[model samples]
Target: MKPRSLVSQSPTSLKLTTGCEALDACLRGGFPCNSLTEIVAESGCGKTQLCLQLSLRAQLPISNGGLNGSSLYLHSELPFPFRRLHQLSKSFHLSNPNIYADHNDNPCDHVFVQNVHSVDHLLDVMPKIDSFVKSSRTRLPLKLIVLDSVAALFRSEFENTPGDLRKRSSLFFKVSGKLKRLADRFGLVVVITNQVTDFVESSDGLSGLRIGNLRGLYSSGRRVVPALGLAWANCVNSRVFISRSGDGICEERREDDESGSSSVGRRDRRRFDIVFSPYLPASSCEFVITREGICGVG
Candidate 1:
């Protein structure tokens, strides 16, 4: 019998670059492919915007620390923000038509966007997503798969009734398991956005009542929240919390004072906190959304 070559048994790893030099350096590359990443935050926290930027960045060539593949943006609550995507693309100076163009010569040919409002619709579209990955021949890899706000589908579909708590939790476990398998088979970075729910004390005092806060309210009482609870956090490899800080005015004044000067001035800052990670930095960094690209705001 012939001996197996060492190369045949070795496992290869895919590491994506985040497009932010500092962040990429800290991550030792970017998000790992074939893994699930969670980004959680409240409304107006710039989670969606960061996801959009990452989606665009994932299509660059490998020399530039990208997979040069297509991105699938699955928006559960809203339409695709095409204008924001275009603006970011222009700012990054990502002018490679081969990376963005389709067979028919469209600029955004590689970017696929879908809005899924219902859990049933999401399930129905599973096969299509798989087909896209398989048909791409893995040469033009499917770099990223994003589910913007997974909590929406669960909250709307499950309702988190007292009687259905066990059933709903079981269903979420199954769904999350399938998502993990999908990421492994396709060699893509799977990103899921989640909304937080308040943990309240229960009448029995043994366990607490969990309330979904999609609109940022905890008034309507529910026995359990529909967000898959702790299981959701455990299923993903990393989690990022994005939030806004400081008014834009402070930076405006600094910019005005530093006009015609080359010194770096105060700028409106957005925070990207690495809240959870298995192998990355845990510190928060300030950044600014610019007409060109996302830059560190010192």
Candidate 2:
């Protein structure tokens, strides 16, 4: 009997591209597999756009900055944006014909979209993805799982109920444990987007500033913190923040436009910051959401 080699038995070392160059560079390649990366930001800060782009990017071959695997997207706050995803796919395929030539076969086929409304719905559906290892014989096993806006369901069911704080805390740990297990066992990249809440002023006067300051749409000149509190915060492996730096309006700024203007109406002057990560350093870079996909602007 031959002994198993360390390379073969060892877990896969791969960096899932975030579908954005500057973002990936900030993340030291991209969101690392076998961990949970939380993308937290205020509403309309390109959180969903990044998630949508990732669904497609995860389907590409590793040579083209993908895991060559499928994804499971748990949509919570909004309906699945298939139209925007289609636009991104079309844009990428046209730019790299040879790479995405089999474009007729959409990556959406491999990517599963689940609309979860309540905690019950989420708990019921999540375990099903684990069954793929046994039932899936032909397709690539699941590699990525994204939960957009993890705070919506719990905020309604858990936070509001009287004396349910403990329950809510435990519930989060349960879900987090499952996700951590799935990530470690299956080498899946679990990325979750969390909504933000107004930062409560503390006696120290540093409550808002300590968490991370944003001068964007929802900031309203007052800082905000990621919702779901400390219990939910302890579960995530990486937390990335998205915010608009200048003008706070998210629009495209094209220099070649008919008007000889310089960054006139572009609102998407966004920043991607790696708040904390064991493997990746704390850094930030700017990117824009264009028709094609998330691209490094500066």
Per-residue C-alpha lDDT of model 2 across residues 50-142, encoded as one tens digit per residue: 988887788778887788888888988867788987788777666655644445455557678889998888889768877864477636578
Q: What is the C-alpha lDDT of each candidate?
A: 0.67, 0.76
In model 2, how large is the Cα lDDT of residue 15? 73
- Could you tell me the lDDT of residue 39 within candidate 1? 75
State candidate 1's TM-score: 0.76
Write one digit per residue (lDDT tens) for candidate 1, span 168-200: 666666666777788878778888888755555
Error of 1 at 92 (Å): 4.2
Q: What is the TM-score (0 to 1) of candidate 2?
A: 0.84
> Each prediction's Cα RMSD?
6.4, 4.3
Best by lDDT: 2
Which stretch of 10 consecutive residues in model 1 shows the poorest summed lDDT? 211-220
Model 2 segments more than 4 A misplaced: 1-12, 96-104, 160-162, 202-221, 246-266
